[model samples]
Target: MQWVSLGDTGSSCPAARSTVAAFRSWADSYLTQPSDELGRDGPVCPYVQPSIRRSLLWLAQVPAADPRPMWVRAIVRDALEIYPELPTRNGSSTSVLRALITVFPNLKDHTLIDEIHAEFKTKFVERGSMLGQFYPGCDQPGLWNKDFRPLDAPLPMLVVRGMMTTDFPFLLDKPEWADAYVRKFAPTLPAHVRSVMVGRLTSRPALVPAYEVRPDDESCSTSS
Candidate 1:
């Protein structure tokens, strides 16, 4: 498989060799331990701030799509982006998500994108919140938590990929989002799939029913 060096910026998936090794090392170290700061039991990047910094830098140029699809593969690749230069006060997880959503159109797959986003939110945000709290009583994430530090990783990052069919539930809830979703996914749907979606969207009754029925007048039928 052809690979590009980090920052080389040619085609895609261009992670440098050293950067990959370094990321492996950092991931092994940080991911191996539980993060006490956030009162969580998972790898916390901030615990090894510098290591995460270097990894994020490498991720900036590495392509998010896996070669299997681009070329055959088992693991799905997800894109990672960082906004390090933003002003301290201006940086937030919301900002990262906005940036990610803005770029979603260009990517090839979005299922992984949603998965990655949810992963971070669950691991970092929901782990110790009312969703995860106990004994003291169920409280909202912000108050009553020890530090309220889910999105506060060592770096601000967003994972993104092409959108997927499962996204319809989220998109179809709103008229505007549904409209946009139709425009985006319709062109790619099979004729039958498109017909089914259009049928549902337009609130048209299905043409076929489960059981056979007499044509208009059952009395007209003659018994053999």
Candidate 2:
């Protein structure tokens, strides 16, 4: 029999070409498989799992001296896309704020910080309102008696006595409701100073009107 090298015969040698063709056919058959047969537990495909941490770290490490890079914002938005659940956590947004503050000290300026704080407060108020919609307990009226009067006393004593007379009964009857009220109320504050003032007012024993207890209402009066 005459021998023909597979390379020299090029496309014309059936025998030599058949063997090469057969090998390729077999290799391709062995490599290709039904998608269902592939194990799901194997490492996630690279195209599916982007390196979120590395990108975030790189953004964090950017030189503070340079003006805030446009890429950092893009990376942040990308990271949020990769992990959409991040904003749901209470501290997660605050952590991002702290990171930005570190990277851009200009964020600490009173005007800028106040603006950001106001924006966050607005978001929190909106969230609280949404929560109130789902949980109507957030909007319920005071269960205590309005006519009940605390004894006349000094300023602090009068306040305490008044709360005991009006707000304490309901708060005591429903401590969980009191707590929910506090949480729903606190987020409406636009500034730390306003928050402090609101906290002082809410902490006193005073009956907040049902209408005034809406998620966004920060002004609660001592009287019903």
Candidate 3:
């Protein structure tokens, strides 16, 4: 639950500070700039620049030397508990720009990190948040291009942020996840996207969401 601004990680270990510094550089140079290899005409992460400008990006260190699964899970649970209290902008669409990165500098087990990410991602999505797992040499591929690895950061960390309509691609494959997306964005989804969701829902009639998705909620464009 120990959150710190990128500018200061008070009393944090040298390893923690070093990891934070590396992430700062990565966000500044890589995330905030466009790359030809990315197969898109924007930065690696479009929200990053606004996030940095608004001072909504935060970092937390899990100073665990042993890296046991139970202990790591405990820190992650704490992070989830505090995520709602993190700073956010005034507009509903603006909340998605904020991010909380929980770093595990001392953890050497990349497999365990992946396991934890997989185990917790559902819970995050259910709560209207997205959790991203990043570690050195991670093989997860980029969205627009299969060859690009957008998530291979210099450290092992989990990032949490408010979910946006742009996340529909990630949710469409899973019924419960798609249900969550529909619950939040059905009212504002573009016609094509709604058609896709309707097709998906009809295909699995038995797995339909609990609520009768009504087209009445805040407006969120596809670009959001």
Q: Output the number of the lDDT-best candidate.
A: 3
Q: List the residue pairs that clash in candidate 2.
A: 163-205
In the range 37-124, model 2's lDDT, one tens digit per residue, is: 2333332112111222222211122223333435434433343333323232244432221111112222222233223332332232
Clashing pairs in 3: none
- What TM-score quantifies how close candidate 2 is to the native fold? 0.21
lDDT at residue 178 of model 2 (Cα atoms)? 48
Model 3, range 76-157, lDDT digits (tens) per residue? 7877777777767665544777788888877777888889888888888888888889988999888799999988988788
For 1-224, candidate 1 gives per-residue lDDT tens digits of 33222233343343344434444464466444655554545545332343333222223322444322331111112222122222223344222211111111123443443444444433222111101111112222321245554432222224222234434544433344455556655677667756655555555223323223446665556864
Per-candidate TM-score against the hidden true structure = 0.25, 0.21, 0.83
Give all candidate RMSDs, comma-separated.
17.8, 27.2, 7.7
lDDT of each: 0.35, 0.28, 0.79
lDDT of 2: 0.28
